[model samples]
Target: MSELPLNPRSPLLPDRHPEPDFFVADIFDATPKGDQASMEHPLFTLATKPDMESQEYRHGDIFVNIGPSPIGRATVHDRDILIYCISQMMARINEGRKVSRTMRFNPHDLMVVTNRDVSGRGYLNFKQALKRLQGTQIETNIQMGGKEQWNVFSLIADATIVRETRDGRMQEVEITLSNWLFDAIEAKGRDLLTLHRDYFRLRKPLERRLYEIARKHCGHQKSFRIGLQRLQEKAGSQSSIYEFRRLISKIVSDNASHQHIPEYDFAFDGDFLDIYRREEGGALPSPAKRGLIVSDSARERAKKHAKGWDIYALEAEWRDWVTSKAIEVQNADAHFVTFAKQRGPYKR
Candidate 1:
């Protein structure tokens, strides 16, 4: 195989310029205030309960705040979450710590660029990341990142609605180094790709599809349909698609332990994300929830509700807290060790 080159098309510009091909994206979520987990982001859809431990986002897991006119700004929570991670990286990198290069810019954060800097981990409004860079010399944390790093914080947004062009009036968008990630984006983009923003924004449902597909092949299924079918089988004969989706939702939310919330102990990815690392990035998906627990409160709530979401509500609180404080983790603190595992000191 030929060794691939870096930034073949260069996603970042010298000093930032108007990109005619890109458009700004802003997300809005319709789920009622009481509908979702605060940290999960409004766009996250319902997942099959069975697949959550596997990180399989399910269909309808996310009720995005978008179109037909739309709801509140699409939940840019994921984007904001990533942005917080970026800033934390920036602070740590500036302070001489190395963070992980394998980072996921929260998909929910794709939204209208309101300000350069975005605060809180709720979401990443491209406009907000820019706002974050104003006082600092860097663009988003990604803009200041290196070859091995994802500069997801740096986006190349364009106008979504094209006025004088051929494709009717509509929004279009792009990221800074998409040309470089043509492959990863293509494979991952299929889950929830939006041409409108020139970025990869996977709604909760889309993520579910990707997870299903990933589960089927684990590494070999090339046909998307066949792979999808295999995912269905994993749900078992008793599980309907809907039931499966809700099950997965329950797993993703409760994966982490927050007993350390106020007293968050020094931990590492090995502690919580441990299950994920148990296998290679690909392998067969687990047949059942790895280590999920249904609490008495959750079991009681389940009797009254058709689906389990309050479980998500509890996780959302920590999810939000993680995002909100991610940026601050860069600061020299007593708690930076555990939280900074992904975005912390690098071996180099």
Candidate 2:
């Protein structure tokens, strides 16, 4: 409950030992569990950074600024820990088991779940990630419980190393996740999206961020397109537009050469960039194959209705919002404009 760090770091007791569990077993399977799991919305920095420094982003009314900790700044890499945490909680929820924001778990379980090493350095890095997750700060107006206030909070409220290895390395840990994050999880997980297991293996932070944007907006559709400028903004990248474009261009080339990107393909045409979902036999799936086809001209009109907006992302949101309504939207452009007004713009 307090910001103070726990201490008395010591070796594990003679009786305390790691017990292999389902999560651990899942790691060794040919296909990792990450392929089937989904990451929460608010984690894994979408921007790439090379050092321990603060980051700020403002999209619509939501504002987030992640600060550093004593150990180091929480990088997009550190998000692997939180991803495993959310995956565990979601699994339990799907099984109809009672879950809580505060949890006690063996560190080995997390390492296995996230496809991380179990070495001594791995343990140290895991502990450091805990510090970063707890130390990183965020402030936003995303309406937690329908209230509006300006307050700063960490991804995790507190953590304690409950058990350790023979050499004083942490073995088991307990953490209380911040209420801001927990509330998002509890409110029916529609906002979250699934990610491929190879997501952890991506070498570059930008690559991971691009995958998240694609997975978030593309879903299982044939493809989704966005302007390069908006992609840079959504990524929260501090790089110059020219440099960012160069980086994306390399990814496009790599995707064509080695097919290194996971579950999706990227290509550039004029000012627009498209991320197409890859099917089983290296073929791009078409919307027509899925029995949903829209004329190219209609999509162009939707984009014209909202300047500097992503039509694909908006379309997905509109579809979800109107799915439960008795009357479907007759005028797509009008509904989209209303959605655009509600979200406003991202002002840095």
Candidate 3:
């Protein structure tokens, strides 16, 4: 058998906490989840350096205005903190524990899970990210958690370094999520998506944004196609069409060679980008065709059966499994409940 060649370039970020035991005891097994609202919009900047620019995006009736603080608009990298907190909250929910908007955790744990640096410099960067998150103001009409009211809020309502090391590095961190974000998390199944753990290891801001778009829109479907101009708008890239095309070509070529972008593969056909799932299963059927509607009662039962597992994630997996196995499920809800019961619980 011919062997696949190894990637020639080194990974952009090293695995800071390679050992399983390195994470905090409570959240070592947490699966990363990204809020659907931010994933769908251009809430973050792609600039590697501090970006002191205000931007506006309008899609139909939804309008978003983002204003940056002096330090910069919150970059995509800064979103990692929010992802970590969201993951923690989801984990708690799966375990049937109550979760509040405000969260407290060891700063090291955040860094470890996000594949970030743990040095003194890393702590300083963490502090800066918190500042950007708290200072960047957003005004939007988008509703989250079913609340539909206009509001201006920062990414985080508040943040504090609760403890510090002798060298002045932050030890403990507490963050109060903005009402907008907190509402999304509280909405549960409708407002969050599971992220591939390697999302933290992506080298470029554009790459990260692209992955978020795919993870949000393509999801578990067989494929999703979008026009290049439309994709540029979704990605919030400031580059012109020509420059964006060049950048995307480079990314497409790189991903083709390295296969580093997780979950999905990318291809460009003329002016449209095609996103295809890497797995071999066929596309999921429509809910109507598959009788895929799960009753509230069934959801409760599945939760009990798959304790500590995100029920929506399991549903996605169940759908993929059904398609892959060519199972003609007559009673989708009952079959999913059985699948959950058989899959059993996972350690939180």
Best by lDDT: 3
Clashing pairs in 3: none
Per-prediction backbone clash count: 69, 0, 0
Give me the runs in candidate 1 sitting further than 4 Å from their true place.
1-154, 157-168, 171-202, 205-249, 253-271, 275-285, 288-298, 301-348
Candidate 1's displacement at residue 82, Å, is: 14
Pairwise lDDT winner, candidates 2 and 3? 3
> In candidate 3, where is summed lDDT lowest over 10 consecutive residues?
1-10
TM-score top scorer: 3
* TM-score, candidate number 2: 0.67
Model 1 lDDT tens row, 114-224: 122223332334433333222111111111112334332112221122122252212232223222222222232222212111122223333333333233223233322
TM-score of each: 0.21, 0.67, 0.77
Query: What is the per-residue lDDT of model 3 for residues 1-348, given as tens digits with 9 covering 90 to 100?
Result: 222223345434566777746347567678999988888889999998899999999889999999997799999999999999999998998899999989999888888889889898998899999999999999999989898999999999999889988989887889999989988788875788999899999989999998999998899897899999989998999998878876886676456545678877776743788898888465343343554545557768998999976565566567657766888877766898999999899875
> Model 2, stretches more than 4 Å misplaced?
1-23, 26-52, 143-151, 282-348
* Comparison by TM-score, 1 against 3, better one: 3
